[model samples]
Target: MKGSSKTHLRIVFTLGIIVLSIYESSSQFLNDEFCGNKEVLTLDYRKKPWKGKNQFLLDYLKKIDYKDNIDSVRFRIPVKFWIYRNDDGSGGVTDERVKVFMDSLNHFHKLNNTGFRFYIREIESVNKTKRLNLGYFVEAPLQTIFNHTKACVNIYVCDFIKKKANGATYVVRGTYNIVTKSVMLQRNTSSTGLTHEIGHYFGLLHPHRNYKSGKNKQESVSRTRAYKGSLKKGLICERNGDGLADTPAEPRLNFLVDNNCNFSGQALTDNWGDHYQSETNNIMSYPTHYKCRNNFTLSQKSVMLYKASENKYAKYWNTKDSANKIYHFDIHEPDNTVKMASIIKSNEKQNHTFHKIFTTGKKGLATDKTDWLKFELNTENTSNILIKFTPDKIVNDEITITIYDEDNKLIKTINTSKQIASSQIQLKTLKSGWYFIEINKKQSVSKKLYNYSVELIIE
Candidate 1:
C-alpha cells in the first residue's frame, strides 16, 4: 500500500507540470493572455491595389498621392514603433536611459519620414519572466516568442555575443511571404546595429555577404561582386553599402568595432562614413559614431516602396484626387512679400485664367521669414501660363480658394494680410504670357522652404 501511494503522488506531480507547460504555450499565442499588460493593435487596411498581387499586405499601407507630383510621395501604412526599456537595476533599462534611446529614434524618424507612426512604451514589470534582458539566455527564448506572434514582422533586439557558438550580431530569419504577408527580424545590439538589421527586414542583403539559399559561408567573389555592382550603380561604397545610388562604394573592412572583444580590431567594415571619406551619408552604412547614422537614399526609398507594393503590404499610389494634377517646386527665399513662381505648360492647350487653389503652410519656428507664406495657382483654360505669388507673412497660415478672372490683365495683384487671410483671382481672360509675382521682405533670412507643393487644373 505504501509503494502504491508513492506512485500515485509522482503521477499527480507530472500531470501538473504538463498542464503548466500547456498554459505557457497558450499564453504566448493568445494576445489577451499576454501578462495582462502588453499593448497591441491591429492596423486597418486603407487602400486596395487595382491589380492584386500582395493584396492583403498592400491593403494596410496608407495610400500616398504622388501621381501628379514627384517631390512628396504619399504612404498609407501608418507604422508605429514602440521602444521598451527593460533594463533592470543590474545595468538593465532605466527611465532616463530609455528616454535617451527614444529621443534618438524620434530624431531618426523625423529626418527620414519613414512614415511609421512612432511611440515609446516603458514596461515596468516586476516579473522576471516579463523583463527584457541582454544576454544569451534571454535571447534564446525570443525565437519562441517570435513564433507566437501573429505579426507579419517580428524584430528582436538583444546584446551582442562574440562566441562562435553565438550567431552573428544580427540574424534575420524567414522570407517575406506574399501569401501570409509576414516577415521577421532577429537582431543583436552592436555599435553599428539596428539600422543594418532593419535594412535586412526590408529585403536588403548585406553588401559583403552572399544571400543565395543554402549558402553558409561568405565567399570573396560574392563580396567583390556586391561591391563592384553597387559602385558602378552608385548604390554603396566598397567599405559599407549605404543603399544610395550617388555615394561612392566603401570596402567592408573599414567598419568600426568596440576594442574590448576578441573580434575587436579584426578589420571590421563597421564605421559610418565620415565627411572626408564620403560626400553623402546613409543610414544603412556603418557609422563612425552615433551622430553620423541618419538618412535613406532615394533609391532605398524607391526600393522600399516597390517592396511594399510588390508584397501587397500597402498601397503607395493615391487615386482619389484624379482631376487635379499636383507638382512640387522649391522656393529658395520666402518672406511676407516674395514672389513664388512656376511655369505650367499643358500637353493639350485649353484657354483658362489664373485662380487660387489649396496651400499647406509651414510649421515650427519663425527664424526664416519665408516659412509663414503659402500660395496656389489655377487657370480657366488648358493653355500654359506662368503662375506667381507674393504671400502674406503669417506664420503657419493656409489659403484655399476658387476665383474667377475679374479683369483681363497679363499681371494681377492679390492682397493678403492678417485681416484678409485668403483670396482667389481668376486668370482666364488673360492670354498666355510670362507673368511675374514677387514678394519683398527683409533679406536677412536665408533658409530654403521645402515641400512647397501645388496642384492645378488646366481647364
Candidate 2:
C-alpha cells in the first residue's frame, strides 16, 4: 500500500507539471493569422475630466485663428519605434516594413498641409516572447520598461495582440491614449492603422463619436451654422459631430464603405431623418479597408495642431522659440526624500516666478514614488505664494501635494481629485523662509509615466 501511494503521488505531480508547462506555452504565443481591424482604446470623453478637457479644447481652438500663421507654425515631432521579437530574437517586424510604414504615415499627414512632421529618432529591438504577443492589460508595464526615458512618441510594434472574449481570442491591431502618449500596434498592422492611431494621439475623435455608446445625441446630418430652427435644436454639425464643420455627420463607416473608397451602401439616416454622407477617406473613420482611409479634413488639421500644442504633448515637439519652450526636460530621480529635494530657484528678474514643465513617474519595482522640490522665499512685504500643478497625463489616484517647512514639518496637504486636471494652492502672506514641496503619488501599483508642469509665483 505504501508503494502504491508513492506511485500515485508521482503521477499527480508529473501531470501537474505538464499542465503548467502547457499553460505557460499557450500564454506566450498567439495566433498570428487572424484578421483584425485597428481599434483605439482611449479614455472616454463622456467621462468627467476628459469631457471637460474636450470642450475646453474645442472652445480654445474656436478662438484661435491658427490658419493665419500656418506657414510659420510648423511642428516637428520625434518618434521612437520598438520592434518586438521572440525569445531567441527571431520573427519580428522588418526594418523595411517600418521604413515603408513611416513613409506612408508621413505622406498621409503631408497631403492636407497639416503643419506636422514626424521623424524617427531611434529604433530599438526587443527580444521577449511575451512582448512579441502582447495583450491590452500588459501594455502599461511594457510601456514603462521600453520607454525612451525621454520625451518622444513611443511606438511598439509587436507580433500579435491577443484579446480574449467569450471563450475565444481576437486580435486588436493597435491602441493609443493621451495619458500614456504611446502607440502599440501589430507588426502586420496597415500604415493606415498607424496614422489613425496617431490621429487619436493628437486628440481627433472619431467622426461617429457617440455612435457606439447610444447614450448621447449623435451628430445630425445638417451642417447648418444657424441652429435657431434646426431639427435637433442647437445640434449644428460643428457643435455635434467631431466638433468640426467640414466633416459631415454620418454613422460608423465600417461596413457601409465599399471597395472603391466610397460610401455607397444602404441610406442610413440620422436622428433628424437626414441621409448620411460620411467621408470614407477620413483618417479618423473606421473604413473597411486601409486604402479607403487616408484623409484628414481641414478643420481636423487645425484640431491636431491645437491639441499638439498642449502642455502634455510639449515633450514630443522640437522647437527653439521661447514662447513654445514651456516644457522642460525630464527631472532626474533619487529626489524622493526631503534632504534630496531638487532645488527650485526663483527668477528674481521675472517677478520671483519659478515655472517648469517636466516628466516624472513611479517605476515598476521602485520603492520611491515621491518627487521633492525645495524653494526659498526672500520677500519682505506681505506677499502671497501660489503653487499650481497642471498635469497633461491622467493620474488614476489623487496626487497629494504637501508643503513642508525647513524642519521637515508638514504645513499643508492638497489632494488633486480630478484626473488629467490642474490644481493650485494659494498661501497668502507666507513667511519668508526655506520651504519644501512634496509631490507624491497616492497609487501604489501604477507604473505609467506622468507629465505635468509646476508654476510657482511669489508677489
Candidate 3:
C-alpha cells in the first residue's frame, strides 16, 4: 500500500479462444428459398441489383491469386435470434432447439473451413400470433414492429413459412438494406434449410439460377473459359449462374436427386455442350431432401467472405473489434472470494487503471453474480477510487458496489440504476490497509446474459 498512487501498474491478460468441433446432423425437408426469388425480396432484388455487385466481387476475386491456410484468420459474425410464438407463447422454438440448430449450422460452415464464425449476441422472444407465420406480405409489418437495429444478422424463426420455401433471406441492392443481412425461417426448418438461407444472406446464388421459372440457363461446366479478363465473354461459366468457377453446372435438383442423395434424373448439358455432373450435396442447391444439401464449394466460401468484408457489413465485424478492444472472460467466471480477490498494487506512477469486460446474470453452477477485487492503500491521505461500468443497452442492468475493510467491516456502498455508467467512492483520512470491493447486479434477466465493462482507477 506504500506507493499505491505513485506506481505504474499494468494488467495484461489475453482471452484464450478455443474453437469447438461442430456436431453433425441431418434432417429431411422439401423446399427452400434464397433472396434472389422475387417473392422473398424485401426491397426487390431486381431494383437493388445485388447480383451485379456479386458479379463485380467475382471479377475482382478472379484477379487475385488468393490462397488461405483456413486457420490463419477467423472472422467473427454476431447474430441475434428472434423467436416468434402464438399469443399464448405455446408454439415457439425452444432454447434447446436453437442450440442444436446452431451446432449444425457451425458444422456446415466449418466443413468448408470458411473462417466465418457466427456467435449469438442475443435471443429474444415475440408472442404475437400474427408473426407466428412468416411470408413476404408480413415481413414489412414485422420489420416495423421490431425496427431491427441492423446491428447484427437478424434471424426470425416462426411457426410456419410460406409454401415452397422453408426459409427466406432479404436481398437488398446498393448496400441499402444489404437485405441479405437478414434471414427468416420456419420453426421446424431443417439444418440444411437454415444453412441454405444463410448462404443466400452472404450472397450465394443457387446453382440452379431461375430454375423455378423453368427457363434456367445452364452454366458451362468449365472453370477456365472466362480467364480472358473480359466481361463481354459473358457466356463463360465464370460469367454465368452463381459466377464462381468451381461449382459444376446443373439443373434444379428438386426431382432430379433421389433417395440416396444421388443425381437420378436425365443427364443435363450446358450451353457449350459439356455434361453436367452436378454435386448433390451443395449447400446452395435445391435437393429434393434437405439432407442432401450439405456443403459449400471453396469458391462459394470466398464469395461469402468477400460480401461479409464489405463496409456495409461492418457491424458484424465490429463485434469482434469491440471484443479485442476490451478484455473478455467466460460468462460463468470471475469466481472470486474475499480471500481470493484479484489484487491491484500501484508503485511509482500517479495513477493505476485497469479495464475489464465481463458478463453478469444467474447462470452456470458458479457463485452468485458478483465480481470481487482488492487494492491496498499505503498511506491513507484522501483516497480516490473510481469504478465505472459501461451500461448494457439491451439489459440496462443495475449494479451495486460495496467496500469492506480488512476485518470485513462495511465502509461504503453505492447503488446505481437505469443507464448509470460509473460510480465513485472517495474516503478522507483513510488508514493504510487492504480493502475488498464487491460488485453485483441488482436484478437479472432469466436465461439471458448481459455484457458489462468496468474501468477501475486508483489515485
Candidate 4:
C-alpha cells in the first residue's frame, strides 16, 4: 500500500489474474418478472456518485487549473467473490451460475467499453462460525458478516434466508454495502439482479427513485433523498434524478418490449407531472420483463468510468496491461441451434421433443434466445393442433410458447407458469402452410438439462 499508486499499477501486469482454470462459454439469463419485476433491483447510493458537475476529482483539479503530475489510466478492475453456506460448509453456490453471471457480464462490459475491464481475483468460501451465525441476514448483517479485503470489489452469495421484519419479509436478492464495498446476493439470483447491484457499486441510481415503487412500495423501504427535480432537470446529478441526462425520469417500470427490443409504450409521467420515459435496455432501470434488459446509456458509461477512476482501485488505475484477459468458461447453450434457430420435426409417433436449451442471447435480439420449430399442415382443411409440455423434472417452471404464421407475423404467445405434468394449447383456427413455434424458459436452467415433448394432434 506504500508504493506509488501509478508504479504499483504498472508493476502488477506480471502478477496476472488468478482464478479457477475451468471456463464456460454458454450462460443463462433470468426472466423479467415485475413490472418492477420480481427480480429486485437495489443499491447502496449513500456514497454519492462521482459524475456530478462539481463532484469528480478531475473537476476539483481543473477548478484550480492543475496539470498532470499524475497519470490517469485505469487498468483491469479486480473483483473478488464470496460464497456463504451453512456452519458445516454446505450449500456452496454452483460454478454454472457463476460462469453465466460473469461471462454474460464480461460480454456486456467488453462491448460497452466502460473504459475498464474486470478480473475475478478469487471466490472464497465463508462458513458460518460461532462468532458469526450467518443463518439469515438480509436487510443487514449483524456486524459485516465476513472478513473483507481492503482492495478489489467483494460480493457475497448466500441463500434466500431472511426473517420477516417491520411487517415485511426480505427475499435478499441483492444488496451493496457501501461501508465495505461488498455486494450480497441470493445464490439463485439472475443477471438482472447481479448487474443492477454492481451498477450501484459503480455509482448508478434508479431513474424513478423519487417516487412510485407502485405495488412494490413495501419493498422500496425508504424513498431516495436525491433532489426530485421537475421535468427537464439540470445536469447536476447528485441533487437530481439518477444524475444522468440520457436516462428519462421514469414514473415506475413498464419493462415490456417488442420484437425490435424497443419499449412497448409511450413516456409515462410521474406524479410530479415530470415527463418520464421507459428504459428497457438500461442496466440501471428495473425492467417489468426479463431478457429485454441490456446496455447502459452513453452518459451512464461515462459516469461509471469516472467512478471507477476513484481511489479504491489504485492498483489497477495506473497499471497498463498488454492484454485484457477475460474469462471464457464452458457454456451450456443449446446445440444444433442456428442463427435462425433450430427446427422441430415430428417423429414416427408424430411427437416432437426439443433437446436444445433456450436462451435470449446477448443484445437480447428478437429471436436471440428462442427455439424455433417449423410445422406443416398436411391436410387441406384446418387442423386442430394441440401443443403441450410433458412434465420433465429438469424443464423450467415457466415455458413461453409463441406461434408465427408462414409470413412471420406473430399469431399468439402462450405464457404458461404452472403445470406439474402437462400444459396444452389448442390451435383451433389455423390454415398453416408452414407455421413456426418458439419455446423458451423464463427462469433458471441451472441444471442445463432440458426435457420436454410436444405433440400436435389433428382433430
Candidate 5:
C-alpha cells in the first residue's frame, strides 16, 4: 500500500510540472512599482540627467533644417495604456476615467514650436491572476519588454503594486522603467503624479536627483563634492545639479507651501557650503501635494523634446500615419470587403496597420481573414501601374493577395513570400474609378497584425 501511494504522488507531481510549463509559455510578465500597497515608485536617481539633450537636438535638427537645408519633419510620440482588469476578469477603469488620465497627461506640450505630442492611442486589458498578477514581485525585464513593446511607449495601470501583511495597501502612485521605456500608475493616481512619472520617462530627473539621506527638518544640509548628492560650482556652470543650469542646485526642495504657493526655502547648502537656491515652479521638483507641481523649467522642456524625438518606440510622431491616429478611437478603419474599401489616389499610399481592424472578411480559406485597400487612377493616360504590397510582419508563407476591379469583380490572385511580397502586380481596370485589393492568409492561421502598406505607382 505504501509503495502504491508513492507511485501515485510521483505521477501527480509530474503532471503538475507539465501543466505549469504550458502555462508559462502563454503568459508574459511586466516589472513591479511599489511596496505592499504604496502609491508611488521607489524612485530612481537621475544620473547625467539632460546630459546630451539640448546639443543633440540642435545638431541633429540643424543638419536637416538649416545645415543640410533639406526637408523638415514634425516629431510625435505614442503611449500605449495597458489597463489591468479586476482579478475576477472585469475590465479596469471606466472610459471617463481613461479620458481624465489622457487629459492630465496632455497638459505638457512640445517645445521648440515643433508639432510634437504624445498620442494615447491603444488601450489593452491585462488579465489579473496569480500567473500574471500585479501584487506579486514579477520581474519582466527589457528583452521581454522589447518583444511585446510595439513602436510606442507603454503605460500600465493596476492595483496593489506592493502588499503588506497588515490591511494596508501600497498603491504605486506612478513609475517609469527607463530601460524598458514603460510606465506604471495606480488606478487612482492623480494627473500631477502621472505627469511627473512621464517626465521621468522623458529623462527629466528630480532637481534633487538621488539625494535621499538627511531629514527634512534639518533646517540646513551639506554634502562634499565626493558625496553622492554633491553639486560642484564652477566658472562655467554647475553641470552636476540635475544636468541643467536654469534650475538652481538645491540640497532638496522644501515641500511646505503656504496659501500663495511659494517656495519656502530652508536655506540649505551644497558640499562646498554654498547656500542652495530654492525652486518651486518646476514639475521636476518634488511636491508634497500634486497641486504644488505645475511647470517644467525651460531647460527641462527642451530635454523632454529631445528624448521624445529619439525614443526607439516613438516613430508615429513625425510621420503622415499620425493623422489617422489622432483620437483615442478612430473612425477611419480598414475596410475588409472588396466593395467598402476607402478611396485613394495613385500617389497616395495607404499604410494603416498598427491598430486592429474592426471588420474582416474570409476570401481564400474559410478561416483566412482579409484586409481590403482601394485606389483610383482617373487619368486618360493609362500609365504603367505597379502595385506594391508589404505585410506588417512575417507570416507562415500563407498569404493570398487578390485584386478586384471597379465593378467589384475579382481580377488576379497570387501567393506572397518574404522575397516576393512586393511583386509587380498589374490591375485590370476597365474604367478610371476605384479598384479593390485584398490581402489575407491562405488558411485561417495568420497572427501577423493586419497592418500592411499598399501603394500604386503610375510609371
Candidate 6:
C-alpha cells in the first residue's frame, strides 16, 4: 500500500508542474504581444522633504503661462469622471462628495489654465457585483464606455480595499492606449484618494523626488552640505516612509503626537509643513487634514504639462485622426536641451503647401536649429512629395533640403547657391510609402534662421 501511495503522489506532482509551466508561458505571451511596449517614466528621488527646492518641477511650471493656457484649452476637450462605489452598504460616495471632487478638479484647471472641462459618470454598486471586480473583468465594460466618449481625460474611482495582513491594496489606476488598447495606472486603492492617483494618470510623478528638486534639508544649511546630499549616504531621509522625497522622512514614532517632541533639534517632527524638521502641509504627504493637502507646486505643474505635451496625454491634443492632424517631433541637443516642433498635414490632395506650424528659439537663427526632426502627414501614401521653403525674411545665405526614403536612403538633395531666400522643389517620385525631410543650413557661420515652413502636396 505504501509503494502504491508514493507512485500516486509522484504522478500528481508531475501534473502540477506541467500546469504551472503552461500558465507562465501564457502570461508572458499576453504581456509581450497584447500589451505594447509602454513605459512609465520614474521620478528621481522618493524619500526627501519638499522644502520647495525641486528644480525640475520648478522649470516645468515656468515654461507655460498656466493661467492663460489652461483656460484656453478647457472648452476644447471634455474630461470624464468614473466613480466606483462599494455595493456592500458600508458607505458609498455621496452625490455631494462627487460634486466637491469635481469642483476641486475644475478649480485646479482654472488655476492652471488647463482649458479643459469635466463630465461626471458614477457607477454605483460595484462591490455588490463580482463582474465589476477590478483588474481583469471590469476593464471590458469600462473600456466600452471610454471608447464611445470624446473626453480627453478619463478618471476612474474605486473604494480600494487594502489587505491588512499583506499590506496590498486592491485598487489599481492606469491610462489605456486606445491605439494599442492597453491600460496603465500608478497604484490601486479604495479610499477617496482621487487627487494623487489622478495626478499619476496625467503622467506626473511624485514631486519631492524628481531630478531637478530632490535633496536633503541639511543640504540647504550650507553650500558644503548641498553637495553632500548629492553623494551617497546623505541621500537617506526620514519620510522614506511613504517613498516620496517632498515629504520629509520620519520614524514610526513621529506619526503620533508626542508632547515631548523637540521641534528645534535635528530630530524630525510629525507636524505638517515642518520642512527637514518635520512633515509639511503638502497633500502628497500622509497627513489626514484636507487643508494641508492643497495645490500642486509650480514644479508639479510643469511635469504634468511636459507629460501632457509629450506622452500618452499628448495624443489627446493631437489625436491620430483629427480634422487637422498635428505631429510632434523632438530635437535632441548636445547640451541636453530639447526643442519641440509641430507639423500639420491636410487630408485632401492639392497643390501641397508646407507650412511652418511651430518652432522653438529665434525664428531666423541657424545655430538654434534642431538636429533631430520628424513630420506627420495626413495620408498613408507617403510618396511623391513637394516641399516649399520660405524664410522669414530675404537673406543671401543658402539653405539645403534633403529627402530620404523610409529606409534612410538619400533619395534627393536640393542646394541653392543663388541669393534667393524662398523656393520650392519636387523630389523624385516616391512609392506609396512614408519618407523623411531634413533641413539644415549650408554655411558654417552661426546665424539665426527665421520663419521657415514647409507645405507638402501629393498628386
**lDDT by residue (tens digit), candidate 3, 270-376:** 66566667889998876778788777876687777666766465543533566433323222122234643556444211121121222323432111356566777
Error of 5 at 397 (Å): 29
Tens digit per residue, CA lDDT, model 4, 214-303: 422211211232333563222333334565545655544544456566665455544434443465777776555546667776556655
Candidate number with greatest lDDT: 2
For every model shown, the clashing-pair count is 55, 0, 10, 18, 18, 54
Please rank every candidate by lDDT, starting with the best: 2, 3, 5, 4, 6, 1
Model 4, residue 412: what's the lDDT? 78
Cα lDDT tens digits, model 1, 237-289, are 32223223233333322334233211122332223312222322455543334
Cα lDDT tens digits for candidate 5, 1-459: 999998887667445433432343222111222211111222343343334233543454444352222222344455667777756878576545665666555554422233344544456777654423354223322212423445666777765354222344444456555444567666777666667777777777666643433332111222222223345222212234455556655544544445466655555454445565565656666544556667766566556666665665344455445543432221123243454355556666767543432211343112115556777656544556677776555544466778777776777888765433454477443456666777765433444434567777766
Q: How close is candidate 5 to the true structure, as a TM-score?
A: 0.50
* Candidates, ranked, TM-score: 3, 2, 5, 4, 6, 1
Q: Write candidate 6's Cα lDDT for 1-459 as tens digits.
A: 999998787667445433433333232212112111122222333422332234444554455544533345412222444445445544444444545554555555456554333433212333444323344223432433433333235544444321111233232333333322222322232122455444554544332332112343222211122223344443233222223234444322223323433323345422332434543333333233334445554445554455556553344343233622322211111111112222325322122112112212354211323222334444454465566766655666667777666677887778765555777767544564455656666445324343355666654
Count steric clashes of candidate 6. 54
lDDT (0 to 1) per candidate: 0.31, 0.61, 0.55, 0.50, 0.51, 0.39
> What is residue 184's positional error in candidate 3, in angstroms?
0.4
TM-score, cand. 1: 0.34
Query: Per the 3 Å backbone cut-off, how many clashing residue pairs does candidate 5 have?
Result: 18
What 10-residue stretch in candidate 4 is worst by lDDT? 19-28
What local lDDT score does residue 299 receive in model 1, on the 0 to 100 scale? 41
